[model samples]
Target: MPSNDIAPAINETQPSFNLDDYKIIVEGSTSILTPKSEADVFYNPVQQFNRDLSVTCIKAWANLYLNPKQEGKEDIEEPELKKIKIEEKEYIKKFTILEALSATGLRAIRYSKEIPNISKIVANDLLPAAVDTIKRNIEYNKASTNVIPNLANCNAVMYTKEFDCIDLDPYGTVAPFIDAAIQSIKNGGLLLVTCTDLQVLAGQTYPEKCFALYGGSNLMGHDATHESALRLVLGLIKTTAAKYGKYVEPLLSLSIDFYVRVFVRVHNKPIKVKDNMSEQMIGYMCHDCDSIVNQYLGKREERTSKKGKPYIKYGLSKAPTSSTECKVCKSGVQHLVGPMYGGAIHNKDFIKEVLRINKEEHEDNIYKTRKRIEGMLTLAYNELPDTPFYFSPSKLSSILKISVPSLKYIVAGLGSLGYECSLSHAQPSVLKTNADWNTIWYVMKEYVRMKEPNYKVEKLNENATGYRIMTNEDIKLNDSTKSISFEPNDMSYKIEKLRKLKMVRYQENPTRNWGPKAKPN
Candidate 1:
């Protein structure tokens, strides 16, 4: 651990800069002194939502560990819950947090003041200026008792110290620090990570860089590649954890604009790790038809022992194939991406608790993302089980040469056909569903052909899968089969409830060039 104290002489001898150039600002329940000039230090007022969400998530994470309910039991009595709260307070006094790569120390100070459960926080940065600034802010906020400022390489610090919670909100890919973070967090501790390298993860500008950093290729043309970015990050974390006989249970994973964040509980159980090994998968997504197929990197086999007991056998191998060409696309080979996590991204229970906390406790004025949180969480809660990526209805419409239908109609249509579907929070225009590629295309084809004869269906590429669905005369599917007229009250209720929240799904840029701060030259 680096020393928290800096000599007064050292402070005086430091390069001359305007100390008064910075101003004190308040966020959440804590006050922070931030650099007025971006050149001096980095801070983005837009990430208030991210910080607010972090505070709530940390509280929820602490509550989960400090006040766990007995397995397979009913709700606790009010009195018993009160007793649990008392125990929780006692446990909070010992909880420690490490905010690795804390640029401005704002989040660490907030965690100290806002989160009642946090005890000690090590706010670390490699820059001497940032460390000095954090120390000043800690004193200015009167949070010196809990927030410790350290100047050191974050990877080195994380590799040495273990904390109850570890947060890594790095500027770019978190690949280099992931292994150290996995080793630093305590068993069952929460690891909150943020990666702002969306271009490499989601855009077509750098496929080789994506594969090099994340051990997966990018599906450059996929509409929902943002979701793929989330999976790829999860895959990296899972693969890294498995090497140490550990695994991650993702409590909540989110792909906000320009970045992705995941809150996961890392476990140190070899058995559970072995059991969940097959969750990592390599996906083959086709560009032409938006079809996705996943192949498991690790396969499980069950066999009966001599004593007639069943046991699982594990199979592990290197990444299967890295071909950028898709075999499923009929118009030659299309774009393919991944070798990503095929497991559940968000735990329904954790998201529900986050919602509950936000409703009952989180202050909205400061926690501006509260409505967005509710809206996103609700969407995540209603997402189809086992669905990896979503398809954009608008993208499909463009491809099929048809008008885009109502999202409700598409969701209801899929629901009525015994297929699961929901609106995706990742992209408002995208619909997440278990309906196969051909079936979805079939529904679109039939809907457009019947509703608008002016649309030239014959103009669509015949070699593509959507055209196959359009031209398939052997089997016929109409509006009833398409679920266009089916208006189930429950389905409407779920979507309406989310719509009523009226949350801003994406954050508006507070200023020009608002994004992750540039590293020092």
Candidate 2:
């Protein structure tokens, strides 16, 4: 009965506890029990999206890596579907998960019921009340065999045993648990991490605190700070894992509502770990105009071995990729910004697998945030692999003091000259392109010169960023400027088609004062 999809309904038989003292919550075929007062423990309804995405990703990971079930083995129970692709080779790996801070057991319950081949899940919490709630929910839902309730500090539990997957979704920063989780996870295991303290990770107001926690600096006053937070978290993990001759490869990194979630796989490869410096970088940002540049810590080059075999040679990188004065906008103050993760944040192959899993209609409505997940992953997969960051056409329009050009126009012009342009899930109206600053400035000025000639920069102040940028002779002298077209060619038209689709490409706040809920008092 415990292995069945439908848990026995409450009140079907008498138990020790009074039914009226609590309430029932149903999410993805799993019902959980919570105190009526809610002050006894915490649950945030907004995190339903977080849980939905996690289940899908875990399923994808298992499908890609696990071995097939033996002929005589009994299949693991899953709530809405069969236990993975049974015919595939990846159906048999025992998935051991540690929900390191499962407050009310909702996520743990979902994992038990939804993700297949999960041998055990330690629904861990330091609070006795939370553990008591978990035990009651596990029994009520008939999930005792799949989930093991534990009362202990998260780090204490992680130190004692290894898990195939460790989820560290804590109240605030995930920094304190990073090293422990990395060390305790089995080689090639997965890590699901969430950091709700955006103020500490993304806000410029507390550089000391950000560095203390994540060991990095965020982009100040930039629209893309959410993405910077994602990178900082990944950077912290990459560096921490390297301490034990391990390396982390980011499978999926996302800046969800009010927080950031990243799924990374840890592997023990000393040679791969040696590439850490190349994966990390420093950013120089112009405080006023918001122009930025990055300098990687090291470089990798293709070298031929003694036996004529090709290999990658890794060594030091040159210093100071940017000058103290902003090159594009000469009037701004240059600020040293990051030691952020410089590698590709999303694995294209892994995202393709997640997208394939997302398309399944077995229980589509169960994934409440499925639409958003699809759009975001599509954009992520489209991003140029070498581009480290993004800029919006609005920012460029503001700098030149011209009426904004349509996002399509900017993207088309870049694509005409053979540059790859795509949207970023972090923010709408932003372009992640392979185009240089010169090409960008040329295009914007070209838009003004041909389309909005009425706006003039001649009378502007000499010390303004706009004035300096507009006067740059190189932008004016570029021969490509004369032949550029604002009209979308086939390549640009393709990107625009994706924008036209009926997808939730971006989301607005669902309610006033919507953010992380407070911990139970």
Poorly placed runs, candidate 2 (over 4 Å):
1-14, 68-91, 476-483, 508-512
In TM-score terms, candidate 2 sits at 0.91
TM-scores of the models, in the order given? 0.85, 0.91
lDDT of 1 at 405: 78
Q: Report lDDT (Cα) of residue 484, candidate 2.
A: 78
lDDT of 2 by residue, 1-521 (tens): 01211122223244557679989887776888887976766877778888988988888777664432235432223223224455655444566888999888889989998887887788889989888888888878888887888888888778777777899999889999998898887767779999999988888699889988888899978877888899999999999999999989999988887899999988877789988998899888888777778889999888999999999889999977688887777644888877889888888977888888888743565787788788888888777766878887898788778777888888888877778888888888888887777677877877887788677787778877788887876564355355777887876787788788888766657678877898565
User: Any runs in candidate 1 off by more than 4 Å, and if so which?
Assistant: 1-21, 69-93, 301-310, 313-329, 459-469, 472-493, 509-513
**Residue pair clashes in candidate 1:** 282-339
Each model's C-alpha lDDT?
0.75, 0.80
